[model samples]
Target: MEVRASPREYDGTFVTTQFGAENVKRAARDEYRKLIDKHDSEDVLVLTGAPTSTDAFRDTLDEVLPGATTPYVTSPVVHATDVLNQTDDRVVLSDALRRELRHRFLADYEWETEYLRQASEQPSFIEDLDRVMDTISWQNISPEETPELREITAALDAFHNWLAEHDHIERGQLIPEALDVLTGDDYNDIVDINAVLAVEFEEFFPLDRAYLDALTGDCDLVCIAEDDASVRRTWVETGAITDYVSFSESRRASGVQPSTRPAATAAYFAEETVVDDPNTGSVSVLAADSGDNQLATIANEIEELIEQEGWGYDDIAVATKQSGSTVTETIESFERSGIPTESATITGFGDDPAIRELLAVARHLAADDDNEVPDHGLELDTDRLARVGEMDQLEDAIRWWATDSGVKERIAERETSLDARSQFGNVRRAFRMAAFLDDTAFLDATWESFEEMLERAHEYASQQNQTSATDLDGGVRVDHLQAIKNTSFKTVFLINLTDSEYPGDPFLTRLFPTERVASMPDYPGVTDLSNTDVDQTFPTDSTASSRPFVQYHAEHARRCLAIGAEAATERLYCCLYEYEDTALEERAQASRFLTAAYADLPWVTDAADPKITSEQAAEEFLLSRVDNALADVRRANSQDVTISLDEVEAELGEIQELLDKSGVRGEELRKALRARVEFANGEVRR
Candidate 1:
């Protein structure tokens, strides 16, 4: 990027920034001089072609070393493009491509009420029933004596009955419906099913079918019966059955399973061995603890590096496997620590208003030319934008993208095909062509439109809703993965890095054909088994005993490891909990080479520090700051002529009251009083 003239004699050095090139011509000359043994100033050749790295190379040599020879080569070719023709060679979509992909993500939305209505009429209605069971052992309290308690009890009974009767019902659908019914009518005595549904609505209710099905189908309800005999009797009477059964009296029955509970919630902490002076330096582990408390340790280290080593916050990064909770916690903690961290932390959210607005403008420009809105036309007005910033209007724009027709149209034009396209043929070609050869004018127009839109959004947010709190920089930007990567940190704690998550499930990933039968050993012909008086399950084809060449798990692991490794730095930390740890470890190993070669940092395992919280330290720190501020104020006030003795006395009384309330009274109070007196005396003299 740098350009300057070179010295008379060809040398590797250029007269600019340490790594800067003289002029393009001089750089070319220098390159040639380095390439050739001796450079004749009069015998230089010049070449030029498309505006690329090649052009820069040629121009640099021609200008710097005048006699340098260069050959101009042109074959009507642009920059080299890596065409992903083979399926194996293809890379996952980039964020931009992903955003485009999202538009094509067939939105098959099914409402809860509607789905229930349609499914209610199906055969095997009771198949959906959870179970019907009545416990004979009841509290001796009379229903008349405790009506409210009785009502609640009765409601639970009714709920249990409904569950048993409708055992065939989708638990996912039934649970929501049951909750809705419970919360709706107090007549039943339990919190209405409808009301309970409302409480957990967002958790189960999803925007897409995949989300809904995944939530519903993947989990099973675990019922623990206090009396198994009673449960079986009730189920038999109600025509309800279970997939499995156990009773204490039966020979097949097993006793209650032993609890596998660790002595402490923090078993890892318990396993830690503390070291003294020689190993006083902090230990580095996988940071497997995903909780906020664990992240606090990592954040504390970063803070230590900043304060002790004098490194900027930007110099260190906090990377997590995915842009999720750990990232959010770390960034929020950083800001809470009074550090002005930038919009780089990959908290699972969206982008900064400034950047988002720019991107919106860019995306708009990248799409089409004719749909320019007034908002997109204006040049960026910093002051006006600042006022908008004050109001925190980015939320409005995000909301618009989520809902508004115009914005949706712009997005759709840039991304989705105007036809019901399959993953083949003309659609793919159209997408590629549109992406590569997008109209320049349209892109410019879109940008201008977005700018104008942002201004309007800001104005509305600020002027109309001043009283209401809008986003004022608390939440972290999460829109783009690259942006997320840019803001990621050193200690990355990835959760849910399981087979069902990373490569996703077979159904979701659609990696293999849905109709493909799961490969299993096929039994061989055993016509002579009678003669041997035995049955054989061996397959005729020995090769059939081996699994088909399906490499789903290995493939998924490779991809996941590749991504994690690519994102990790020298001090990378991969954290997963016991629930997910085994699978994650099996799936991928910690990134190889660096940390092991350099040094080993213990992961500071320990008994959970007796919860003598840093909260207490934080409180003391805050009080100290307040005291310092008070000292400065008193010193200034004593020298000022703006107040009377009455004002001084009032301020003193207030300070004393505050001190008493805070329990920081005594010597500190005396010192403050003396300082105030000295300040007053100085003021009087002045």
Candidate 2:
């Protein structure tokens, strides 16, 4: 049993905690402590991150007898193989270990869990999966294996169905037999499982990837590495590094990073390392690179800001333009820097520390207060929430009361009897169904209720369609920059502000006539060129007002610049990267808003100075465009190849525009256009 508890206790109950790297260590330590207390020390071993491993070893030396030391290890490689060897050689050699290995294999591609569950729900698809798994199975198992396999399959299928119906499902719903059903044979089909599972799950799985790559390449992906023994390792998570690093890596490795990386550039850590020079009391030269460092670096500067300039954490915000990877990095970096942070739309609950923390609390409370369930229907009087004491306890109580089947059934009866507006009734009923997992007795009860006031909250959260602003004790907020637009940040790192990044094309469901120009009613029409050709020959009327690139750029630029203006009291920091470019024009255009706002205010660069030259900037820009074009080819191919003649014409027009811009209508551009046309036509013909 893991004695995972928070360090901070609020009024005898631990406040809701954020499950983090530190929390993992603490949990491991407590588990070891419990083992000793139970005098089961020989069977207990601890595994933690490298840093934690060293600390745990030092702390345990005083208590553990010499040479009787329980193993303390870091790195999954050492822990998994070694621990299995020591704990159960028979257990490891048995089919059970093989099954465990299969489960681990499934876990690698578990992004398809939703897909797998959905497919399992489909009797036909489930049959297909069964067949697939059977194809890999070698029949050397005990007579009990068949029944056990069927039982495990049934449980997995049922679990997925339950999760689909409910916004969130409780853990422990997956029983041990579920693992018992899976074996080494099933491991062989994990990749095929992902592919087939994706299609059956929804058009969203494959179609979203197809469309997202069309709009931008920021969708989820998996990579598999095969070894000499025919063993394969798969990695599927994203955003371990900052956007600039990811982008640079993409460019260097693949000519372009998948656009699905979600075009984020800057990140904020919880550190207080300000860009101000103590000697001059003015902007520091290091401010340029200052904005580019991870949250840890930012946190250090922020501390300095407080010490030197009397700034508080509340006076600052750690922000980035894109949400997915950049957001994750920012949160992780903040944790490392000892600054609390949250994100607007965190994906998969597994990756989100906050949601996991909430779940952990809920589980603990449910277990501790199992006797509290009333046979009679419970009506939540927010006022009575405090009677439960510690806010965290109340939250668990509320969540259980709200989400439990018995509780929901009772609430349905009450709602049927009450006279209320249908919309509010529906909304309130939704809470009864989903349950408020956050503590409701605290001042936060009203707020917590809203968390599940609508069933769609889960969907919105899943799709990252909603923007949430979080206040983490201090003035720190990880919010939608758009939400707090016009508000000033003490030091803002305006990331992903690249030309194609900030106002990056949103998902467009409609396809208009290729001839139609993108223009407002008040503006002269300009052909909506898809990066290929532009018919500048459209009759120009001086009287017809037109939307210029300058205007569109300016609006975003103003938003970017206003962030700086709002931080009048504090040093403003804007961090951007120019990939593969070495030209002044490209560099100048890269931070166009900063360049435009150059004269009115003081601007500075960081000492970890990036050599942004005119030539380099241009090269990066050109390469990015070229890379995008090739990527477009791959993405377009993934979709039905039917190329519309209008689309072909549009491509030609985009090419013409590029030629005009370059002032070099070389044979290469012409050849590329021809190749695109050929590919499109080939697809259409097929």
Backbone clashes, each candidate = 73, 53
Report the number of the highest-lDDT candidate.
Answer: 2
Per-model TM values vs. the true structure? 0.27, 0.30
Summarize candidate 1's per-residue lDDT along 190-236 as a digit string, tens digits. Answer: 31111000000111111111122222221111111111111112211
Whole-model lDDT, model 1: 0.29
Task: Output the lDDT of residue 278, model 2.
Answer: 26
Residue 399 Cα positional deviation in candidate 1, in Å, after optimal superposition? 18
Task: Give all candidate RMSDs, comma-separated.
Answer: 28.0, 29.9
